[model samples]
Target: MKTNANAIAFIMEGRRQRFRRWILVTGSLAALACMLCCAMLLLGNTIYPVQEVIRALMGEQVKGVSFAVNTIRLPRMLAGLFAGFAFGIAGNTFQTMLRNPLANPNVIGITAGSSAAAVFCIVILHTSNTVVSIASVIAGLATVLFIYVLSRGRSFSIGRLILVGIGIQAMLNAVISYLLLVGDQQDIPAALRWLSGSLNGSQMDDLPYLAITVLIFAPVILMLGKHLSILELGEQSATTLGVNADMTRIALIFSSVCMIALATATTGPIAFVAFLSGPIAKRLVGVGFSNALPAGLVGVNLVLAADLIGQFAFEVRYPVGIITGILGAPYLIYLLIRMNRKGSL
Candidate 1:
């Protein structure tokens, strides 16, 4: 009896520690994201020195700085912060649940779906940003559903999901190429720009849609985090413990898809923050944290760092996505190597 009691007490204490770690890590990431956002706003062309920017935040009388901070930079910074966080959290959710670090929305063609749709809209359909964004959301959700159905032949398999995803991605890339080839010469620049995955010209209009979507769906993602942790222990064990495996998987996938779709709609599929952040977060927190929150934090950090680097790293500015792809693709290789070396893959 005493031994059983001790075991229970130890487990309870461990759970407490885990919860504390989650809260601390999440809070710290949130703070860092905020700071990066402020820097993004204040360190641009026509930067309003830090003092005046702060005064503007506190509603003091700063003239040109207030206009620059509140009018111009604030919107872009807010867009990047929220969109980065959404992609990170959503990516982590998919990776942990599938128990595959490569199963992020960006990896498995959801972002590509958005990219394809946006490219088609920009090049072929000749639509504005609003139409392109809506199309991207619809296409993103549709892509996930299509992949899920195609992968459901014998039994649902990760291998199938991944294969279909890769196939679809290749096909989408071809279509993008074709569109650019045959597109109007004038429109080609616009389409090519979107394909490079930029966060430039992110106006206030882009924020409300994503902001509301993230705000509304964020609670659902948080609640699903507990299910994700259990689901990580194999589907059979999860089902044995009263978890509805199919329903749970569908719901989590849906939540993640929406987050990715919304973010891609705003920021043009900012590459592998989704693919890389969760595994990195796992390394940081060791085996204890499978909650998806930490992965999202790491995701936001990765994107922000990449964006800042892209913005001010050299004479010429690149889109945020290009920089992240360059950095994240290599990090992904390293992660796979380490995982393989340790027999963790």
Candidate 2:
């Protein structure tokens, strides 16, 4: 009786620990995201005080502050925050599900698919933003399907999927380059800007759809967090645990793809926000905890922080994606070297 009681107490204690850890990590991330959002709104060309920024946000017509905060900064900040969250969640889902850090949407040709479609619309069709967004989402979904089908050889292989995705990304990038080379000079700049994953010129009108996508899909991912954790235990183990591994994976992939595609449409690819968020979140939260929300928050922080840096760090303004890419490349190289040494790749 005493042994059983002790086991029960131990299990209860573990649950309590996990719950506390979750709250701490998520709360910290939320606070950080909030701070960055405030900074984005307040620290522009003519830095407004927090009170003025708050007033502007509350629909007060505070002269200069209102116009700058509402018309310019608000939309940009919203786009970065939600899009970063989407990227972070989606990327972490892929990495966690596939058990490979290289399995991020950006690394695996999903964003390339969206970028290719958007570029095509800009360069060849002269399509509007709405059309570009629609085409990008469709292309992203199709790319995932193609990768899944091609990589399925009697069973799913993470190695095969990642390799095929990399190949597709290269091909799609070449296609984008070819289209640019043969297209009108006037459209090149617009296409290039989209490809670079920037948050500049983000408008209120463009934010609702992306926001809706995150709202609708993010919960689905979070709801399936338990299943996602199970998936990390490998397919056979998950199956042994009574988890529907295939269906759960498909559901996760679909939800993640939707979020990522919309996010890419909203702010291009945003460099490696997706790729870097998961590992960072895992490191911060440690093992034996769900890091989905934490990872999303990390992404939000990275995007907002990088945008601020790009805007004010240099004499010449750089895009958020450029800054993130600079930050991500070294990490990518380091990861590859470590993985090679471990013979894991």
Candidate 3:
């Protein structure tokens, strides 16, 4: 009877600790996201302060700040926030399911596929945002399908998938590089900017798709999240526990691809947020559990912070993606080395 009481007390304490951790991390990330949005809304070429930005948002006449903040940065900020959320969650899903930290959408060529297609459209076909979004989604799905088929031999294999994805990414990146080389010099800068990923010119029209995609998949991600956790305990063990291993994998891959594709479609595959968020989430929350919620929060924090840095960092502006890549690449290398050292790869 005493032991039972102690176990219950222990469980209650653990739950409370978890709740406190979640509230602290989630709350901090939320506040940071708000500040970043406001910073983006206010700081720009015309230089509106936060006060004016708020007044403008409140539907008052605030002169130069009003037009720029309302008509310009607000939409772009929201797109980045939502896109980051989608990438973070999707990336976490892949990593958790495969039990591999390198299984993120960006690392596995999904976003690269979308980027390659978008660059092709921009340089060759001169497609608008809508056309590019549609094309990117299709291309992302096709690329992942190719990788899956190439990797499959009656069962899923993590190493094969990662290798094939890296190969595909290299080839597509080469194509994009070649296109840049042969393109009109005038458009090359713009193309490079898009390739680097920026929320520079988003509009209200983009929001409908972004909103619809995240809203539809958020609940699905939550519902199936536990199965992903179960599937991490090896194939035989998961099957023994009555988890449909293959079906779970396919669903997770499909869901992750859709989320990443939709996000890249809207935001031009902002760099490293997808690749970086999962590991950070894992670190923050400790082990023995899924990292989806913290991953999504970290993603929001990364993009919001990067966007703010890019906007206000120095004398010159940098793209958000560039800043994240610069920061995330070294960490990725470290992760790879650690995996190799521990024989985890």
Candidate 4:
């Protein structure tokens, strides 16, 4: 009896320690994200003071500062914040639910769906941004349903889903390439910018849909985080634990698909933000609590910081996606190599 009590006490203490670490790690990441946001506002070409930036944000027109801060940087910052959060949360949700670090939206073709739709609108349809955004969302959801159906035969298989998603993504990429090859030269530049996952020219008007999508669906994913962790334990274990595996997975998939689609539409997929956010958050927050929130914060930090780096880190300005791709490619190669060595690929 005493040994059992001691074991229970030990488990309790470990939980407490994990909780503390989670709080500390999450808080630090949030603080860092906020700092990066501030830098985004203040460290542009002209470099406004913090007080002037705050005043401009507060509706006080301060000589040359208000337009720059409110018109240009504010929209850009908000885009990074909300879109990054969306990517981060959605990526973490998919990874956790699928129990595979490589199961992010980027890898499994959800973002590719959005990308293909947006590219089609830009290159072929000559549509407005609004049309592009709507088409992207519809296509994203459709892609999820399509992949789900194709992977659902003879019991759901993670490997099969991933394989199908990869194949679809390849086909979509070919379509995009064909469109670009035959698209108008004027339109090709626009399509290329969007395809490269840029944050250039982010407008205030383009944000509400993305913001609303993230606001509505992020909480849904967060609420299902416990079920996500359980789902990570395998379908049989999840079912034995009284979790409705199929329903929970569908809910998570739907929620994640929505946010990531909107985000991709908003910021052109912002390369690898979704892919890298989850593992970094998981590493930081350990295992006691859900890492969705931390993952989102990490994502915000990545996007905002990458934007800054792109803006100031070189003689020539690059897009946020370029910076992120530079950062993420190495990690991806490393992950693939490790998985290959373990025969988990």
Local distance difference test, per candidate? 0.80, 0.92, 0.81, 0.90
> How many clashes in each structure?
0, 0, 0, 0
Task: Using lDDT, give the best candidate's number.
Answer: 2
Q: How far is candidate 3 from the true structure (C-alpha RMSD, Å)?
A: 2.2
Evaluate model 4: give its TM-score. Answer: 0.97
Per residue, candidate 4 scores C-alpha lDDT tens digits across 1-345 of 999999999999999999999999989999999899899899888998889989999999899999999889999999999999999989888888887888888888889999999988888899888898899889999999998899989898887888889888898889889999988899998788878877888999999999999889988888988888898999999999999998998889888888888888888978899999999999889887899999999999999999999999899999999999999999999999998999987
TM-score of each: 0.92, 0.96, 0.91, 0.97
Segments of candidate 4 deviating more than 4 angstroms = none
lDDT per residue as tens, model 3, 207-251: 787778788876677777778888888889889989898888787
Per-residue lDDT of candidate 2, residues 1-345 (tens digit):
999999999998988887787788889989999999988998988998888889888988998999899989999999999999999999999999999999999889999998899888889999888888899899999999999899999988999999999999999999999999998999999778878989999999888889998999999999998889989989999999999998998899999998898888889889999999999999888767789989999999999999999999999999999999999999999999999999999
Model 3 scores worst on lDDT over the 10 consecutive residues at: 282-291
Best candidate, TM-score-wise? Answer: 4
The candidate, 3 or 4, that scores higher on TM-score is 4
**Deviation (Å) of 239 in candidate 2:** 2.0
User: Which pairs clash in the backbone of model 3?
Assistant: none
Tens-place lDDT per residue, model 1, 19-133, is 7876777788778877787787788877667878889878776878877777667776777777877888898888888788777787688888888888888888888777887
Scanning candidate 1 in windows of ten residues, the lowest lDDT window is 283-292
For model 4, name the residue pairs that clash. Answer: none
